[model samples]
Every structure is written in structure tokens, then in C-alpha cells.
Target: VRLAMGARDLENNTVEVARRDTLTKETLSLDNIENTVADLLDDIQKNIFRKALNYRQEHTITVDTYEEFKEKLEEGGFILAHWDGTPETEERIKAETKATIRCIPLAGDTTPGVCMVTGKPSVQRVLFARAY
Candidate 1:
């Protein structure tokens, strides 16, 4: 989230802008206010997207075994693991690790594999996570 506040002094024809993202304040002439704010908004959007992408890349993990999955779950992030398309297996994993399937991602690697927990045939890896 980004916040910008402007304190305008009409008598002096000056606008002081405080930016939340950079934690900086700058005084600008009235003529530059619109252009400056527009630029800052664009920078804020790119900054937010970059941070989120970095975080996901850092936290997301792919595990091939239940032991690895449970170990990673303790650290708390998204898990990509094979799931044998079965409710019973899904329920067991949740009951055991308190983690549930967040999604069967439609993108990325769709290679078939054996279930991490059941050893049954799995169509693809699925995303798993625990509520934060």
C-alpha cells in the first residue's frame, strides 16, 4: 500500500508531498504536482509487484516427499507437491500437518508423478498451505 499526502500553501504556491512508500517528503511547485504524483503512483505499483514476486519466489518450495513437506510446513509458506487426487489422502495430510491443498495450479510444471504421501499416481503437483 502506498499513501501520499499533500500540504498546500496557496499563498506561497507550494505543495509539500509526503510519500509513505519511500518515507520521504518533498516540496514541489504547483505546476509539477500532477506530474510528480502520477510518476510516484507508477513507481509504487511496480515496487509492490516486485516485492510480492520476490516474496513468493523466496517462500515457495517444491517437495517430493511427505517428510520434506511437513518439514517445510513448519517454516510456513506455499508447498508444491504431488497429490493423488483423493479426498481421503487430502484429509489425512490436513489432519496430520494442518496443511491443506490451496490449489492445483493451472500453470507451470504439469508433469505426472507419484503422490508424496500415498505413493499413488498423481496427475501433477498441487499447491498446499496452512492458514496464516
Candidate 2:
């Protein structure tokens, strides 16, 4: 969020408030400016967070096979797939698809499964993404 006050506007007792997230601007009176700015800032924070969470949820994908993993990799975003928990398998996936394990998420779907690539037992799904 940004606040701009021009000398001309100072004479008129008004200022401009610009929201970075939405790229919107409004002219507000000097009276209660502090409270107005504070409220706008809080609202902006919440809006940005909601937008990011929605984007992540929409982009995240789950795959059960190596073919599906490779197919999804081309489309981009986070891929949740079983891994054998071995460095060699990790290296092979990265080498093949240019996607690396972003993390072993601590939350959500903890059920065990077989690795998509190696056909070995996997403790859980790991996040994979190609660095931007």
C-alpha cells in the first residue's frame, strides 16, 4: 500500500491512497487519515494472503504414476507424488524432468504408498516443482 500527498492536495485537505495488491487508488480526506490507512493496510494483508492460498491450492496436483508425474511436470506447479526416499531416485527425477523435491510436507495426507518411479515403498508423498 502507498500513500501520496501532493502540495496542491495539502491546500485542499485531501490525500491519495493506493493499494498495491489491487492497483486501485482513492482520494481521502485528511481527517481520520491514520485510521483509514491502518484499516486499508490490514485489509490488503488479508486479501494478499487469501489470493496466495487460493493460487497454491489451485496449482497443486497429485499423481500416482511416473507417466502422470512427467505429464503434469510439463504444465508446471507443485506435484505431490510418492518418492522412494533415496538420493538416487531424487537425482533421476530431477535429471529426467528438471523438477526437484521442494519439500516433504508435514501436513495433509500422511498415508503411505509406493514410489511412482522405483516401485519401492514410500513413506509419503513429497512436493516437486521446477524452480522458476
Which residue pairs clash in candidate 1? none
| Each candidate's clash count | 0, 0
Model 2, which residues run further than 4 Å from truth?
none
Candidate 2 residue 88 C-alpha distance from true site, Å = 2.0
* Clashing residue pairs for model 2: none
lDDT of each: 0.87, 0.95
lDDT of 2 by residue, 50-98 (tens): 9998998899999999999999989989999999999999999999989
Query: For residues 44-94, could you state the per-residue lDDT of candidate 1 as single tens digits?
Result: 889878988899779899999999999999999899999999999999999
Worst 10 residues of 1 by lDDT: 1-10
Candidate 2 TM-score, true structure as reference: 0.89
> Which regions in candidate 1 have their CA more than 4 angstroms from the true location?
1-8
lDDT of 1: 0.87
